[model samples]
Target: MERDVVCLVDGNKHLYDRGAYLWTLRPSIVNRIRRDYPKARNQDFICFEHLLPYQVEMIQSMMRSDEKQIDKLNRKLTRTMEDQEYRVTDVNETLKETQTFGQKIADRVAEIAGSWGFIIFYIIVLVGWIVINGLHVFGITFDPYPFILLNLFLSCIAALQAPVIMMSQNRAAYRDRMSSENDYHINLKTEEELRILHAKMDHLMQHQFDHNLEIQAMIFEILSEIRITQKK
Candidate 1:
């Protein structure tokens, strides 16, 4: 079997870009067994059961790293983060998400401005402004006649505000796009790890089955030889 894989993190594993699997084992313990009982030194059993002391130490280091990561993550709110890469990607993703939200709000404002309802509301307000000013009721008419100027003024305000809002939204959209790309990559890696795990499991199981079959065949052969000897 091709044993090609890349990157294993805190019980999470990935095989290229085709699969991912997340699992956990006490590396500190298992690694220790592998190290302290190196198969080469103790050749009485299968190699899988023996371990080197160095291997155990490596597991201890890995455990320490995992613990530190978990502690860091517990203090934050993120999709998947507890390390440098995860943190960088998460920050980028957050920036993107925030930008996306801002753009959506800006889009809503633009839509409201373009709607007939908004226009009608402004018209009514303008009429009331005219009445109040012409009749001098509350004497609060700031801009009297030439309601066209009022329209012009409002238009100018929109012209300036719209671009500013849109500009802000545009910047945010760009950030979001970058973050989404990173997320996609990470997710892709995760998928790859999953596929890799299934493949590994299948291979391991098949190996076990074949091994059992071999043992059974050996037993049968021994029994057959015994019967022949008895018959003789």
Candidate 2:
């Protein structure tokens, strides 16, 4: 029996760091992360939690394949990926349908910036005005006369900032949608490869069964020949 292992492949530093932190904490899961965060530099794909089965299989495959053969295979796969029919199908749509996770943080951040954060800031500003008028907060009030002017300013700022904050949320949602699509495509491709593997396995099993049956028939014919010779 062979054990499963995980490896990570990331193009973004922050995402890579996230993966490293998680894998280091629990050295059991091994998966590859593919990310292209423009802001994150110096972070590349990393292999993690190497297990026995994967190592053995890798070694076996490598031993069976020379560099030239491997290159040929890779090229073939790449060409297949570039086929017109495959290209026509939208990969993003498939990824959107299937993803590993939900973009909760993106949603929450957008939500806060759009609504809750504004509400809280507004409350704080209103309190500050009340304190100034009533000489509250240890008698260190700055704007002493109810501060109608400041109140007007705060309201104006809130009105403007609210829309801007809402824009940020909308942007986040777009990014979330894109990320979801990426994850879905990865899964879709994985399942496709699994199907190919399954087909190969089935063919191998059928071939072995047929070979065994042929061997059984051969043995029976040999025994019959022996018996006939003894009867003679």
Candidate 3:
């Protein structure tokens, strides 16, 4: 009859069953334990107890590494968020902050020209001018039948107002672009935070599963010891 084999780790000896103990463990788990206990080279003759401190430490080390990586990402994202907040990225605020004398004048002019009040008032002035000139009530016609001077005045106003509106529009477009970029950065940070949360959760769940398995193994060991004692 073959006697049961025994294994040594950390100066403690335990039963070694190839079929029940050795084969049941994962290769990575075995490798990590072997790495920690360098003297345990002959694993076939060596056995490890359930819930080893070294195995727990290995899991904690892995969790620490994951936490460190998440912290690094958090720091980077925080800096980016701070930078974005510090700068004036708001479209209206940026336009107001960077407004030059000429830009302010252009924006004001565009605002007035774009209003319904300005349109209605200009229409009234045009009609009054045409009526006054057509009736010749004052017996003096400043802009005659063809209204050549009126045409020139309107053309000049159009040329000047077009450039001003275009300048204001350009500034608005630049402000909008800056706001869009800031929004993208905010969204990216949010996504990174969510990813970190998911990774941490996965790590914790895996650690818990391993711990539960170790606890079950320890229970089995206690049950085996009780059975042997009862027989003796």
- What would the C-alpha RMSD of candidate 2 be, to one decimal place? 29.3
Model 2, span 1-232: residue lDDT tens: 1222223333223222222333332122222121222332233233322222333343344334444444554565555555443333455565445433334444454566668777799789787678766766676656667676777887897686566566556655766776676666666665665665565456446654554564465456445544543552
Query: Which segments of candidate 3 are over 4 A away from where they belong?
Result: 1-88, 138-140, 212-232
lDDT of all the models against the reference? 0.52, 0.48, 0.65
How large is the C-alpha RMSD of every model relative to the true structure?
A: 18.8, 29.3, 5.6
How well does each candidate superpose onto the true structure, as a TM-score? 0.42, 0.40, 0.60
Clashes of 1: 19
Q: Scored by Cα lDDT, where does model 1 land?
A: 0.52
What TM-score, to 2 decimals, does candidate 1 have? 0.42
Worst 10 residues of 2 by lDDT: 25-34
Per-residue accuracy of model 1 over 53-107 as CA lDDT, tens digit each: 3334554555565456445444442333333453235655565466656566666
Please tell me which predicted candidate would have the highest lDDT against the true structure: 3
What lDDT does candidate 3 reach at residue 213? 69
How many collisions between residues are there in candidate 2? 5
Scored by lDDT, model 3 comes in at 0.65
Q: What residue pairs are clashing in model 2?
A: 6-30, 7-31, 95-184, 95-185, 96-181
How far residue 146's Cα lies from its native spot in candidate 1, in Å, is: 1.6
Q: How are the candidates ranked when ordered by TM-score, highest leading? A: 3, 1, 2
